[model samples]
Target: MLVESLAVLTLALLVEAAIGYPGRVYTAIGHPVTWIGALIATLDRDLNRDDASPAVRRAMGVLALVAILAVPGALALALQAILSGFGLLGLLAAAILASSLLAQRSLHEHVAAVRDGLRAEGLAGGRRAVSMIVGRNPESLDEAGVSRAAIESLAENFSDGIVAPAFWMGLGGLPGGVLYKAANTADSMIGHRTPRHDAFGWAAARFDDMINLPASRLGAFLLIVAAALHPWASARAAWAAVRRDAGRHRSPNAGWPEAAMAGALGLRLAGPRTYGETIVNDAWMGDGRAAATAQDVDRALALYRTACALLIGLAALVAITALALSR
Candidate 1:
């Protein structure tokens, strides 16, 4: 099962990486966000109450999740059928084609651009480069702020952008993988405490949290293993630091990898940030060593590259193990 899953995921990854996304009429309509939003609308129709019970809210949340899971499967089957209509091998080629969009190397290079910009042009340049990486307002940051923001985005999105989708897809094929990405995107766009989405986005946020749990810890564990050669990081350092500081953040899962990353890099992450109208004051982690300059950002990138190598290498190892075990 693991071997089959890995083969499928690898094919998908290669597809996305090579040809990239095709701008097709159906694909634009069937993108993950579109489906998630559709599900949210469908789910919200039944729960249009100012006084819905907590039980009712939770039940509705669960129901919404059930629907969200099916959307990816539907998209994959549809895509496969279309590709197969042209030729059976076309379906296989399409799997490889779609994998080109996964963006492993692209993510690394884009993040690295910030560090290079900061080095070449200082804070203003860093801000310009990094604003592209993060969604939050970045116009107001100083050099240190820009560096911190980049590091934080680098660590967190590494989980969502790379690890989580791969993990799910490696387990459940393309449908599972795509749906996980879809769920995460829905949570990011709509999951909030604001009035517009409090109830409507409830299911997405919770389900995203549930789905991210294992991947987050795996991220931390792998970071520890991957960055083992770094002076400040070891398995012990990562484990102790994560246990001590992960609870400091607001999110149940993000704190684990972030704290571990902070600990591994000998820096702090998470604190005050504004998202739109909200001012969220989150607890901090790591030592005050997190007072980062651009130099520290470069070092962090080095660590990240090291960690990424370990992650991909580990994935290859897991694939081998699965194939061996299945035999």
Candidate 2:
């Protein structure tokens, strides 16, 4: 069962990289994340009450997390069981469904758009493109700020949007992936330090951090290996930065990839940044250039692509080994 799950994960990664989630399909039925996000919104509206005590809200948040995971988890389990009975055809169907959980192609496109915006439309264009991917205030960003924001988003989402989901699916199959996505979606929606969400989102935020721990480290290793392969990137520096700086970022998981990418590409990332009117004074990653350019965005994309390729290779190797051992 574990071997089959790994195989399905490998296929899902390949399929997502090849075609992505098509716009037409999304327009017609919406994407899986959107579907999950809708449920999260409903839960937040229904369960999270403003007048409730923090302790009560925290407990409600835990309940909400379980409810959020159960619906998709059960559906994925049923689908996986039914498909397993169909053998190869069912495997293909499962892979296609699992592919929706990854964001390889979409992440590339969105980050590339920032570079394009910087090139064609200057700071305004860069800001516009970057605003789509990052939570930071776009208007506050200069050209370098926009570039850094895009690269940071790219690195962080590389872990969250790809590695983490793929890691879970490889371990526990379709239901695992669905459940991880559900928890991650909930975290993003409510896991802020705001007065309303501080207690209510506690469980989602903590669980997300715990589940992401392994994938975060694995993702950093992948980026370091990718840096070794690229003439322009530095594997040693990447490793050094991760060792020196990963734990400094606000998020325990986000720091690993961000540090690796920053070190590999020889750029400083994730210093002080604004989200709305709030400025987060965070530690910088990598002892390199702070004035990141559109060109640096391109460099980060190259490194990202190499890291993604490495992830695919790793998945294939695991699937093969798992199958052989099972046999």
Candidate 3:
């Protein structure tokens, strides 16, 4: 189990870094997150009835979360048992499945698209590009706002998309990773506090928050270390910002990485922002420049890539250590 787990973690990182989830594969099978999303959506539509009491809706959410987790959890166990028989071939298949659960490449692509859009078409283009990735009101964003939004999304997603999944995979192998993904996908699909989801999505939101706790801190730690390596970013500032500002965000977990990234890059993030018709007066992270530009976005991406590399290297070291200890 340890050997296969280690093998899957290492190869999945390499595979995702190299090609990501191929568009062809996505076109064929949709993505695993999307598949998970469909299930969540189905549950939300069927079970999250307006007539249901708040307590009942919340219970239904818990049941839905359990149902979503059980399917992938069982499959992961089965796959591990079957692969344990085939040796290296089984490990390779497990690695492939694990890679699908990661979002390193996709995250980069989505953020890069925002940068490119800003560069190619100015504020309008940048707003349109960033809107695809963020739930904020794009029309209200200026250039700096758009750039900050992109950087914030990159930082937050790094924790949720990359670090969180890898953290689970190390402990629970492929199913652990998939289980985390399911929780995350459910959170995104139905976890909002709006009238439609506030009650029904309570469980999904809370579960996602609980599962992401450790990875969020780990991700922030990696970003701080990565900042030490970059001439432009400050490790001290990252740590300081994380301590000071992470608690200010609405989410119990997301602010850690966002604050770290903001401090590392010397750019302020998570300030007052518009979300659809609402203006969220979020506390600003990092006492740095708020007027971000395309160059800042690029710099944030550079910091992000370094952080990601640092994370993968650490994961490799952990895998090696686990394999050695198991032996």
Per-model lDDT: 0.71, 0.94, 0.89
lDDT of 2 by residue, 117-164 (tens): 999999999999999999899999999899999999999999999999
**Regarding lDDT, does 1 or 3 come out ahead?**
3
Candidate 3, residues 1-327: lDDT per residue as tens digits? Answer: 665676688888888988899999999999888888888888888888999899999899889989889887888788888887888888888888899988888888888888999999999989999998999989999999999999999999999999999988888889889899989998898888989889888988999999999999999999999899989889999999999999999889989999999999888999898888998888999999999999988988888898889878887898888778888
Better of 1 and 3 by TM-score: 3
lDDT leader? 2
- List the candidate 2 regions with Cα displacement exceeding 4 Å: none
Q: State the number of backbone clashes in model 1.
A: 15
Model 3 vs. true fold: TM? 0.97
Better of 2 and 3 by TM-score: 2
Question: How many clashing residue pairs appear in each of the predictions shown?
Answer: 15, 0, 0
Worst lDDT 10-window in candidate 3: 1-10
Ranking by TM-score: 2, 3, 1
Candidate 1 lDDT tens digits, 1-327: 456557666666555444444558336555445656676666666653547765666566666666666766588757655665665376466556346325566666777888888899998789899888876577767777788888887778777776788788788655667777768866875567666567666888988999998888887787777567776555566677789988778998888778777777777877777655566798876665656777767766777767666766666677788988888
The global Cα lDDT (0 to 1) of model 3 is 0.89
Per-candidate TM-score against the hidden true structure: 0.80, 0.99, 0.97
- Candidates in descending lDDT order: 2, 3, 1
Q: What is residue 153's positional error in candidate 2, in angstroms?
A: 0.6
Which is the winner by TM-score between candidate 1 and candidate 2?
2
